[model samples]
Target: MTDIPEELALATLACRAGQYQTSELEQSEALFLSSSFCFESAAQAAARFSGDEEGNVYSRFTNPTVRGFEQRLAAMEGGERAIGTSSGMSAILSLVMATLVSGDEIVASRSVFGTTVNLFKNVLSKFGIVTTLVDMTNLDAWERAMTSRTRMLFLETPSNPLTDVADLQALADLAHQHGAQLVVDNCFCTPVLQRPLEFGADVVVHSATKYLDGQGRCLGGALVGSSALMEERLVPFLRSAGPTMSPFNAWVFLKGLETLQIRMERHSRSATVVARWLDEHPAVRRVYYPGLESHPQYALARAQQSDFGGIVSFDVADRAAAWRIVDNLRLFSITANLGDAKSIVTHPATTTHGRLSAEDRESMNVGEGLLRLSVGLEDPNDLLCDIEQAIG
Candidate 1:
């Protein structure tokens, strides 16, 4: 019912992100489900295609619903524009494909998702594109890894599964000094808790299928950046390559955006409770959560993020022991996905980051006993009791 507007706070923008109430108008944002709209005349259609007029021509590159989602997400992210993709991986692919030529390099974090690691080593390697993965916490590694060929610095802060905090300001500064763009995956905190661009990241990416969708119902990803880069470079690649986010899924994301703030808050509160409890558990070896007072980067996280994210990673004594706890949990889900309303859990070494070699996993401290928990909006006491029962 409410009109989506540019002049809004992050919380308000979430509720308003993609729905425009136009005409005599309905209260809720309308889903324009038609694949194509008939133009008033042949000349009008030509004008629309030629960019002389502003309206939807096809659901592929241009659609009201998808555009609405893009606008809303972009607004919420504090980005100039956003382009939604079919998946988070697709968004990364589109970004690299569009911006880099044959010789450009990427300085990425080693603690990224396993599929992303594969994309860099396997897929991008074939094209003469070089990616150097560095310790996310070690600024020295990032600086030493950079070369004149480097065009992008890509990382996921409070990185996947481990919740390793990369100093965003430091990474951004280093990248910019070397004439590189900083691409941050804002999937973990979403805009509800953190805005990477505000901390000097040049571009922000998201697995909207996660927190942005909030319900785990659809697959989607997004790239948010300056309008110049998003429209001129990314949009052209998306138009040709066709990894475009579907209109129906975009509508779903739009719906998800409305409650993003509240859900993230609850997720954070619940996660902190779990992380704190785990730190005291006899089976737990180490807990990695920015929210914890004992975390190495706790101060930095507090300075930047409004709240700690839902993800909490911990280590048990051994692989068998970790599996014992994970296998015993009844309420938590054993899935790779995070940022859902229902709590999810996974053993990173054998699941999310399983593809990495032993050395790679070891360097990042992702062990057989490493477990990542994505806390949801469940009762904290119930979740904690479930953990106690599982580990006992």
Candidate 2:
């Protein structure tokens, strides 16, 4: 294992961190495909299994390729350690299960991904964990939601589909005041734009399935935090539960990290262009993007993030109009997934947030007309032309 300097820029760290070389000295990171590692002797095997030694025992908890990805992401996010998971939802599950017991509670932003709402409301509720959803930007709402049992404050800034930005510092301060940990999902911004840990977040979670994988080629997730939280809490749960990322996916994500920063910058630029175009269009009743001056949290976004992110959402008149636009698009794929090399357009009311009750959807302001666009690396002009033709 070669140590990457702390002083190296994020782009350099992305490329060089957590690199391990074999006896062959290959420049690229090697893939260890074996399920379990071999030990030199019975004593060594016993030691490894008993944690008296630090080496791979099983791929479920210890694999070189996955460890490398974890190390690299931890360094990028300024976290002491990271734990990899099979998918984004699994990461959140592992974090909640590891940190909170029955009778504990979470205060979360209403603007999170639809599945996250279901996870907290439907799944965790069955385990005796309570969740309260509040407006992302309303500090008063967040403060009022906390209680003696509130163990965590969870939110996604520039939130899913809506693009509503939260004040990280304020939320962190509030959580700490109540002796609770602040957990921020960094899926949309990645480390290239906003690092939640730097703003006093105790934990930063990533759907590495999103921008971290860059090309949408793999399903993965990670939790980045202090060594104590990761090793003491999350690791045991992961080892027991076996929601483990495969070595192949980890290798794919490693390559993705090398180009992540550059791709995010391009995505931000293109998204900004599309957002501006939508803001001026008569067909678009409203646009949701932190980069736009019209955005409620534009100033806060400018202060906290290096750039506005790649997602841009807008509303027309109704679901029918939104569907017409989506159906006519030549370039954008109509999919629920986001953060791909190819542009994606989703009607959130019918797809991402469809499962929520109408009242719940209304609270999140995910209207029937809402169209969420995951702007890609395509030429901004080409995307604009596509939108124009679709609208026509």
Candidate 3:
């Protein structure tokens, strides 16, 4: 078999990838909102339902707009198939619900999104699944934590709020050795900064609401992998469970994908400035950007990701100081979400990560003083002033 060209420059792919046109010669992608397609006869409808005719049967399973987004995302991720979901968490849930069994186990990094930890520990536990969370940076711990029942390894590199860099290539190798799959949450870094599949990961998940949309305008998620995994495993679950991505949301996400490369570069540049400035600030105790030299896995981050990413996390003196900074930010959105074209600031201890138990929070080192800053397309100087005045 000939090797596929996964190394095509993303800029080139962004321009030319996933464009399926008809004799209608429409300039922009069209949205298909109808519930069902018009078949020539009952026999043809039956063929579509039975997979004999490769056409859409229902909007829930097959829609042109959703399929367009999937194709575009799959091309960007260098994968054969992509499945979009209603939300980021649903993408993960569908993956587990489709792939893993009741007795199966997962060895995952504790530094993933708080909701993700909850899903695996609390939600999946109800169905007889077991999850063991470990320090993402600890390779030895991951090796020791694996069991015969282990079927998957999950993680979020440059993880939420704290920017902990997990070694994707290493973990992928380890998972394969244990007869398991590695599922990397490509939410923070995105395809613009990192491609886990190139590093040996079996599947890549995305919270398209964040960096992929490059704006907080849509809520969508995606799973990209081999055709076998998607068509056989995850797609069937989505067809029934109906964790479906809307055609409108998918169209919005596609537009976001157009500018992803440039947006991510700009966000990285501004965030580096913010993270560096925060590290030197008087009230700021630490900045948790992977770009920082002081970061624990700085070199690993440099190697694994194309850019340091848009998120700049920091620690103030205490919870009061953190709140002061957040409360005073004039230009940034004070929401739990990140990866927007507009700047966003959040205190994970009280917002995103607050859902985790105290022990869980402590284990992940999500401190009371922690602040997550998602630097957008704003001028870096203005952002610096916004945070500095907030500190004062």
Candidate 4:
């Protein structure tokens, strides 16, 4: 029941913010597993339903556990409000649904997660919403792609598989100039590493299923922004459409937040070592890690992010070579999910970006030989040996 002081560090906020302890005064956050709450009387129930009082009416939109997670995340991200959702994809869908109308346009980064590209192109297009994809690093490309109908500029910095970094401040300025909201997916970096809102972004979206859970346990998502926009647009859409995160998942995410700062620091340090090793390896045709000096956006990443994050991707000769290394890895788990305690190795040409057209993949430089590594808390020396033998 204590307020998070403005002077508290991020580590303090992650561990203690948004905790509303009951009279029992539990030290850790309590897991409220109930579906709904009972009112003290009929008038109280009526008042809650009529929005005259603030109280839990249903789990879908008013679960205490979910709200605690929302409050904690909003505080961490420096946003005034946040709305929790069932999954990361749903978070994006909710953002679009809440803000854009029929025939509204979105200018998005071509180097985004493959599924996100599909969602904007395939799913939202059916509803008359259109998306234009352009190179993420090209400020001029983003300017050219914008139209009068553009309602949003969406992108993921240090993007999936490629580790492509975007100039968020420039993009934010461009979006506002075009009367569009900039929505940055902070999944890869989390708030511990990079905060999009500090750079003038209008909104920040998250796949809490990733680093927020930090162990591949639960699926959830969130949208964070000013209180006015959140209460006016996002909350009502989520309440009615029901893409809401479960109370249990919210609790799990809350636990994940507690250890987020330390975990990210470790992930970044290990990934830097791994990236350097891969860059030196003869078989690795190219390395894509923001921490590496060879990375084209290294300066930009250092400027914008506190850490470079855990993902380290590289190129081989072909798909066969990429699969060989992935199949040979003994220490790394071969899976699509990133931001886990166990390191993951995936052939992006066959898994994450497999659905995109060959031309699309080529444009994004997702080569046939590309392999994505989600470096975890493992010993860096062991990871290097595993990858070295795998490459051989």
Candidate 1 wrong stretches, greater than 4 Å: 1-7, 22-24
Q: Please, what are the lDDT tens digits per residue for candidate 3 over residues 1-392? A: 11235567887566446655556866677777787788999999889999988988888988888888898888898888899999999999999999999999999999999999999999999999999999989999999999999999999998987889988889999999999999999999888899999999999999999988887999999999999999999888999999999989988887889889999999999998888887887777778999989899999989989989999888877898888878889999888779998999888988898988989999988899988888999888998898888888
lDDT of 1 by residue, 167-206 (tens): 9999999999999999999999999899999999999999
What TM-score does candidate 3 reach? 0.97
lDDT at 201, model 2: 99
Shift of residue 95 alpha carbon in model 1, Å: 0.6
Report the error of model 4 at residue 7, Å. Answer: 2.7
Of candidates 2 and 1, the better by lDDT: 2
What's the TM-score of every candidate structure?
Answer: 0.97, 0.99, 0.97, 0.99
- Candidate lDDT (C-alpha), each: 0.90, 0.94, 0.89, 0.92
